[model samples]
Target chain A: MKRRIGAAGLSLFISATLVITGCAQQKILDKMGLSVVIGYDRVDKDRLLGTNVLHQFDPMASESVQIVASTAYTSKGTRDKSNLEMAKKAVSGQLRVTLYSEQLAKEGIINLVDTLARDPTIGARVFLAISKGRAHDILKHRYPEFGNIGTYMYQTISQNIEGESMISPTLHDFMHDYSSVGRDTILPYLEQRGKEGNELVISGAALFQQDRMVGVIPTKEVFYVKLLRDRFQAGSIEISIPREVLGKYMKVSQKKRGNDPIFLVLDTLSSSSTFKLVDKNRPQINTEIKITGRLQEVSEVVDLSKPEIIHKIEKAISQAMMNEGNKVIAKLQKLETDPIGFGEIYRSSVRHSNLTRDKWYEMYRDAKLNLKVEMTLVRTGVIE
Target chain B: MKSIGKPGEHQVFSTFFLFWVIIESQIGMGILQFQRKVVQVAHHDAWISVLITGGVIHVVVWFMIRTLAKYESADLYEIHQHALGKWIGNLLSILYMAYLLLLGTLVLRSYIEVVQTWLFPEIPTWLLSSSVLLLTVYGVLGGIRIIVGVCILSYLFSIALLFFLAYNLPYADWRSLSPVMEANFQELIIGAKQMAFTVVGFEIIYFVYPYLKEKKKAGRYTQMGVLYTTLIYCLVLVLSIAFFSEGQIKKTVWPSLSLFKIVQIPFLERFEYVTVSLWLLVIVPNLLLYLWAATRGMKKVFHWNQRRSVYLSAALVLAICLLLKTNLQIKFLGEWAGQLSLYLVFVYPVILYFIVLIRTRKQRKEVK
Candidate 1:
């Protein structure tokens, strides 16, 4: 009976110790500066201007987020400096977006990217973008609609990618492409727009030659880049068909406004791509893209009930896609960036060989690319 | 002496539980980083190396079980005493106890390192280590029955974590594993050697063999356990290779945790935090079983009370873990433990098998 009592007392003492130790380590939500969005800009060749949008959950506070800025030699160094000025300790475990100014990205982002990749606390899904102006300026803009700038930027980028306006490249995806032998990474280019330049916009995609930004593709041409690089789905493209093609079938006046050719807008419902390396020495690639879409808009009245008319439209659309795809491929080749991963495909197809990065780059610079597009019109609009 | 297993006291484990014990032991901290280690050596052909390693382990396990079966209802400690005599056997048993204690320490320290890096950076090492050690003490005091129960429960709870790996399929590029057999035989062997540590947990069967209800069926069940572990290792390795490129896998320290970074549930933003927390369940069983084995060995060798020996072993593990504070020291400790286990589980088993075989032959000759 005495031993039982002593065991009970010991157990009580252990539980009491556990309870005391547990509370000392408790990270109360309010006490932590949950940094949701972080932006980096080049202060000089040796320093970085870092800005972070710290999130607060207190209902009584006037603003739920406060922007903090600091200058340091490294990313973590910047965080440490910024923490000294903040009320709460800055935590990056909830980081949603990492933005860099175009100037800084043009210098090199591999160092910052390495820091993110090395930290196991940071998730791989965080969006990484290159801002048109200073990244700190973008972070400073008040996004009243989002309540928090970090969440707002994250949601905007996520929704755009899901809606097929842009390709979503997370930090993990960028690291994969950067580390892989034959591929380079692309990130969404964000810019400030609106009457006062207060609104943030995903302008286009910034292409990288190795780790430095070489150029940007305009938003309108992003579709062609996507068509060449990724399997497409749920994106709409408008193609201008020559008025002469529909001269006999429809009234030519309706096909043209003044001297402009009529535009046929098609909404892609589904798409798939296949690439084959036909030759190794010359490095010729045969790329076939199969697309299925519904006709959303047609300027001229055509006999949609006729299968031949549909076939002609499909041929015209395929021809237009091929022309645009060739132009984009040529541009990417001239820029010496293989975001389309043709070199990766080639590497996978070949046997054991000494295909180094320089060898692939040289081949890609002169490789002949043959593009074939097969479009199937799955449905026409209700008016048709 | 208190009998660990009496005639009819529900002490003997069923064949089904035996299978889980082997699995829970083999699939702990090693699964988290073996992909990177193997890939560092074999490159794209790491999966094949894993298969070869599994086959080699099966042969070693076969030798171990055969040696243990020579003396009925006797563990490795008793077998050592019978074959090597009292003084030499006691020395070997003490070494085995130290080996087991080192195993437990390596596992605990590795797990705590992961937790600190991934989950709680602010929590001190002693706080976390002591909490885990306390739970381990509670579980160990419950004896083998409770340890086996924890193993079974750990298996059931953590088995679903593998299913979460399916999230990586969409991102997996099958071409990354292309040009199969790219690594030559020598490289593949090196890769297999790197895998020796992760697969060493199956050797626990030599200690647990005497506690089985149907000792005759233990070999088959144990093999099944090994086969399941191999399949799991293969699946994780293949997925890791397919998900990350060769260069990327080489750079990642914990490829398994990195793989979990891509798993995004609707309600959960950071899946790895959840995984690391629940992984304590997976880690506790490994710590408990190894410490239990070490304490049991010590009890047999020194004739110490089992409870007192358990306390001593746990304290030893905690002290060693605390002493290895730096990442470099922890890494060295892991490598040292792996090398030691490789010798004990692989090389020593084959040598002991021959000894047992020659002794049996000589005894029959003397009887005639």
Candidate 2:
């Protein structure tokens, strides 16, 4: 009887404790406001403009996203002020993309990026991009196809990166590169293309010296930059062969008539790049890039069936890639940015030396780059 | 002296169960921040420091087991009373109990800090502390057998989290750990010293030794437990070094959790949130085992009821956790507890081993 009473009292205590603690206030799906994409733009020297597209799942309303803009001294301050106007609590847990205007990115993004990094709700995979124009305008604009601009922009940037068109950097990746001694990070540079400004396009990539954007490279050149920085899995490059070089491989009549351009688009199957610091004091980099791909398209028909002709095409492609790679390296060197992580390679190779970031930057500016490109054309498509 | 355990209850834990208890206790809140702390001292050579610390801990474990083996079925408390005499031994036993209590409090406070920083920010401290302490109390009330069961279950559930390290491999740059052995001897020693906090909890074996079913094989099993912990710590330390840059590792508060940031799954958006929640399983056993050891110590030394000691210690731990409100205060608490543990677990064990050696030799001479 005593044991039974003790058991009953223990159960009562357990239930009572559970009842008193209650449940955490449930955030109903309909009432909660989720911000998927946030944008930051420079307003002035002291103040800043913050914009976000709040994803609302309304059972009654037709629209699902609201673009709210506010001015504040800091990112959190802006969120708190924006919260006063919203119908529900604005949460950033589902934040998929964050945009920074080029102006703000140039002034420095470390502080804002730190805010995002410090937030536990925001994942490291959230896309971070730099807008060519005002980031606020990008968030405010609407497209007919995408009902929700936030998810649409996120998918757009994510897919382009997966498609190997632009380099996709998350907030964590940016912070990693920004904090690392020998490396600088690049972000997808987005611009409003066409006269209507209705279309948001990922145009090129913005390079950072540290936390600040130093320069932007054109979209075409970004391909070479990626080749120098990362291994390639599935990206295509179009090389325009000189008419004279094409004539050497085929009949003049087959090369097409006057003023017609001949192009070869190679779809990369696999590629790898190796960076070696051959000279420590002078800091000379030997970059070897091996690319294996199949010829996808040719504007003018050239006989790729013969081994000699294939060899000549390979030579031409390697020469073209080497020149392009050199140009990209020169541009990065002129900007004094080591986005290729040449400094990291140098640091790894040398030992027992005190190499500061400043010293590495100086070396990067004066460093000489030697590029070697190896191209293997495996197949010329199904049509020969 | 009265036997602390019933005849059948004394042998409830098998050799394998002993392994799990040592490992579960050794890897608590420390694993989350150990990489950052070690890296701050040794830089890229932190893995080497970890290995050195592992070797030293193996020697220390050997000494502790040897000392415990001198007594037939006596634990550290009984051994102290027998070897050091009544007053001095009782005083040292009290210090050990206080040390165990502080260790439990540090683990709870650190786990709460991680939860507050990572999961629920608005929840009050006393609420979280009470919940964890209640769970701990429940496990302790079940006694050592049930606590070992929880340890076995927690080991099974959380061991797979180590596999998540593979997800970070793609981002890992082997070059970050290159030019190894760069740290001087002093720096490496400091790094190993920093690891003492994370590695100290295995010393609970001195208290748990007498309860093992196969006391003869306890030495091998306990060493295996410490070996497993060393391997895990080394694996995590190396992975953190390879994943983060040297400068980044030093700045990160919780390198282990931060490394999980790179993990992306289709269904889960924030993997760290899931990891932090699952980490509760890993944390409960540490709190349960250490608090149980403390309560057991108090019961033996002061002739208090075991249940009363458990309640008193649990309340003390909860109060300490509540009082350590700020990050700086919690950090100081952790540092002091670590320093105290270094003396109690490392330095004191060696001294006690010598004392036990002399006492046994003198007793043999008198018998002759």
Candidate 3:
């Protein structure tokens, strides 16, 4: 009986000790003022000023609202130093959008990227965008419709690419392209518009040549660039064909419209890219862009299901692709950047130790593009 | 000695448990660090090496079961005594015990290191290692049946842990797996050699064979364990390759851990913290299994009580773990041990099986 009591007492003692330890080791959620968005710009020599946008959710409120502000000259003089200083309280774990000024990106971000990649706190999946205007000014602007403009603008830019005009570039996708040998990095460019109640507009895409921002493309070509890069989704493509070409092609098919230039809106487009290395030594690159698209709607359509109408649309797609492809290629060639990741193909396929940056530029300058348009107008919508 | 007795006659393990035991033991510490070693040799086709080594495992496990089945009541030490001379057999048994001890200690230390890096940075290494040791010793005290029960419980935790890898799918670049079979056949063979550490631990069955209620089912159970282990580790390996590029995998120290850290939970900021927390359940069972084997071997070879053998062996392993200072040093030691274990676990068993086979035939001829 005494031994049984002694054993029971010992179990109680151990249980009590365990309870105390468990309570002591309780993981306290350190409310370190989680920053949702951060923007960086070059300030002085070897110094950078950073702004972090923070959000605090009020539990009592019906809907979650956010707080936005700018904190500059955060202790660390350099970009990495500034990031680390901000990271202490910012909670980069929740950070979704990271915007960089054009000047800072143009200066070269390999060093800054290395720091971001090495840090455990900063997420690799966050969206990276290049601001067309001052990144600080864009961050400072607030939209009356969205309470927290930082998150609002970030999501607005990303979500718009589905149905509207934009290019979606997540941090993961950006990093993949940036690290690839043939491909360069691209980011959706946004800027503040108007003076009073400023609105952020998604411009085109900022193209980079090995971590250095080289040039930009407008929203018109941004669609074509994305299509060529195989980033197409459910978005409409607007094409304007001269009245003469429209008349020449559409005259064969049915009840023709009276007398306006045909404006074709193409949707549900899918593009496939195939590349071949012609010569391994002085390597000549051949790229084939095949597009599959359906006609969503037309401004002046006489017949929807006619073979001639499909032929006209196909020709229009071909012409549109050629014009847009040339504009993008010319710009890329001028900037000596391959944002399509063609350089990656070269690096992966042809094993050449002597192939330097200058050699790649020289080779890419001469690489040819073949555009093939295969449009299947499966349905002309309910209007037809 | 208290007996939990044979797992009740009706208590057959579920196929899932067989699958779980195999995969859980296989996937342990190797998931985090084996990539570099294999890639160093195999380059792009290291996965082929994995397949080849898996075949090698099938053969080794078969031989191990055949050798252990020779004696119904004994283990590796007894088999060695019967096959080889008593003195040499005892010496080999001691070496085997030491190997198991070193392995357990290294795994324990590395687990603590992971805990330090990912979770409680301020916690002392001794405290973490001691706590794990305390739990493992408690489990070990319950004997083999209870240890296997803890392993079964830990398997459920492993399934939950696997969900964390799904978050990495968004970042996975399929191009990283391109240029498949870039390495030649020789490099592929070398890659398989590095997988030796990943596929080991089923050798624990030699000691465990006696404790099993149904000895005939032991072979099937052991094979099931290994196959499951290979499947799990292979899935992890493929995930790492898919998530990170070859260049990136070569640079990262702990690719599996890095993969987990990338997972951002809606409610929890650091999900790897949750993974590291559950990781204790996995590593403790593994450590306890290895430690029990060492103690059991020591008792058999030296004619000592298991209590004395266990205390002395655990002390030695603890001392060795305390000696290692940094992660790099631990890595270096682990690599060297892996290389040695290839011989101890694989080559030695195959050679012994052949020798025993030839001897048994000769004895039968002489008796006729």
Candidate 4:
């Protein structure tokens, strides 16, 4: 009889435990608000104009509509204030993309990044990009053509991975580059391109010294920068040489800039760059650039492919690379953004130099550079 | 010494559980904010300091094992009573108990602060602290064997948490770890000092020594545990450093969790939530072991019953944790406590070892 009483009591306790465990919240998909994109721009000393793209598929509208809202205040205040502005509860659990304006980025994004980083609500998977124009313009651009401006912007930049013109920078990567001494930073630059009857596009990239934007490189130059930075995976480049220079070659490729002339199109078939820090005491920087490319198409095809002609094509391409490489190097030196990773080279080769910020910038302008381009003409387009 | 039907038989842990206890207890809340503390000294070479500290702790564990083996049946409290006179021994033992209680509460307080600041803004701070502490007391009440067993199980789940973090590799830049050893040797040593706080749990052998079924192999177990814990700690530390550069690490409060937040799955998002949940599992062993030590010390010094003393001590700790005013205060207390306890955990053991050695040599010479 006593044993039966003990068993009955144990059953009641077990049932009660089950009830409590059942009541404890286990997160469900329906309970979460999936935020795919977040945009931040500095409004004033104490306020951050924050905007986010929350994805929603409205069955009534018969299409996907992303809810966009802007709240202006400090991070803590904005977070609280945005809660009331949101249609449904704003959940940053799925935030994948964080967009910063050129102004906010140049002003040093570390403070803004700190807010996102410190908050547990924001997902770490969020990719970071810098808007070339106003962040609000990018955030508010109603491409009624595309479902969501934020989604379109994020997808457009990410697709450049295959092209290798611009790197898809994550919030973590941006922070890393921002902190590294030997390197400045680059962000996939976005600007709302296109006018009426066309959809806005986010393309190209921006180069920065630490946190401040020093200059903007168009999509074409961004490719070369990526190559120098060793971030290039697969991208194409075209250099044009004069027709007279091409006459010595069977076939020569060219890219026309406003129809002014022709430079040989050394369609960047493949390229690799390496940095060497020789003579730490002398404070020298040497970069060896090797590019292998095929003459895909010739503006003027001279004759059947010949060995002499091919050699002429190779020489011309080499000279062109040196000129273009110098131009890029000059621009980088002027800006003092070591997107070429000279600081990293210094760290690796001259481990004991103890180079400080001012010293590195001084050395960078005077650094020696070596450029080498190797070209192989596989065939003359689709013909001999 | 009352007959309990073979206590050692009930105390032997499976190799799996032993591995779990080491990893979970070693990780603690330190894994979240550890890099910031170390970077203040070591800069980028903090990972190396971790390796050196691991080696140092291994040697400390060896000496501790030798001391324990010589004493045979005696644990830390018993050894203190034998080596020092009753009054002094009891006083020092009281110090150890106070340190353990404070350490456990600090862990609870810091975790509450993190949760309140990050996840649930609406929830009251005391409620979260109470809920976590209540669960901790449940494990503490289960005794040492059950605590170790739960640690093993929770460790398996926590190790699986690494899979999500490991997925962020495509985003990792190997160069970020470069400019290697740029921060000189002195900086690295400071980093080693910081790493010691994160790796503090192995000294629990002082309390659990008598519970080992194979008393002779207790040293081997401790070595294996420390090694496994070191590997995980270093792995996470390296991943954090490689993913974020020195500047980024300095600003990041919880690098490991941040790494998880960056990692996304095709089917689901918000990995940080899962990471926090898993961390809850990992910190439980740290809480249980500390509470167990506090209870065991009370039993020895005050002759208090185990059940009554554990409940009373846990209640007092909970109250103290609740009273800890602000997040900054809790952090300040935790850091100061860790630094103070370092003297007890690292310095005191070495001092005691030498004193015991001198006494033993003198006794032998007298006999001869």
Give the TM-score of each candidate.
0.50, 0.51, 0.48, 0.49
lDDT, candidate 1, at B271: 92
Q: After the best TM-score superposition of candidate 1, give how far the Cα of residue A149 lies from its true spot, in angstroms.
A: 23
Per-residue CA lDDT of candidate 1, range B238-348, in tens? 999999888778766688988998999999987988888889999898998998888888777878888988888888888887786545467667888889988988899
Q: Tens-digit lDDT track for model 4 on B47-161?
A: 8898988998888888787777766666777777766768998998999899888888877877765665456533555788778878888888888899888877787777788
Q: B1-368, model 3: which lDDT tens digit per residue?
A: 11212335443344334434555556567776777667768765676787788878988999987876655545777777767868988888888888888789878888877776556543556777777777777778777666777778888767787887889889887676668888888888888988898677777776766666666777787787786666666777777888877766766656777788788877887676677777777787778789888887766776678877777766777777777744545766887889879999989988878766776677679989
Please give, as one word, the docking class of candidate 3: incorrect
For A185-259, candidate 4 gives per-residue lDDT tens digits of 777777766675245544667777877777776776666676677733235677765445554432224323233
* Each prediction's DockQ against the real complex: 0.01, 0.01, 0.01, 0.01
- Worst lDDT window (10 residues) for model 4 chain B? B1-10
lDDT of 3 by residue, A131-171 (tens): 87567777766665567766786677768755646655767
Off by over 4 Å in 3: A1-384, B1-22, B362-368
* lDDT of residue A49 for candidate 4: 79
Per residue, candidate 1 scores C-alpha lDDT tens digits across A299-345 of 77676645577778888888878888888889888988888888888
- CA displacement after TM-score superposition, residue A18 of candidate 1 (Å): 48
| C-alpha lDDT of residue B83 in model 1 | 71
Q: 2 or 3, which is superior by TM-score? A: 2
**Which stretches in model 2 have alpha-carbon errors above 4 Å?**
A1-384, B1-11
The better-scoring model by lDDT among 2 and 3 is 2
Task: Please tell me what DockQ candidate 1 reaches.
Answer: 0.01
TM-score of chain A of 1: 0.93
Task: Evaluate candidate 1 by giving its C-alpha RMSD to the native, one decimal.
Answer: 23.4
lDDT of 2 by residue, A53-166 (tens): 898677677877988889999998888889888998888989999999999999889999998999998899999999998999888877766688898889998898887877
lDDT value for model 1: 0.85
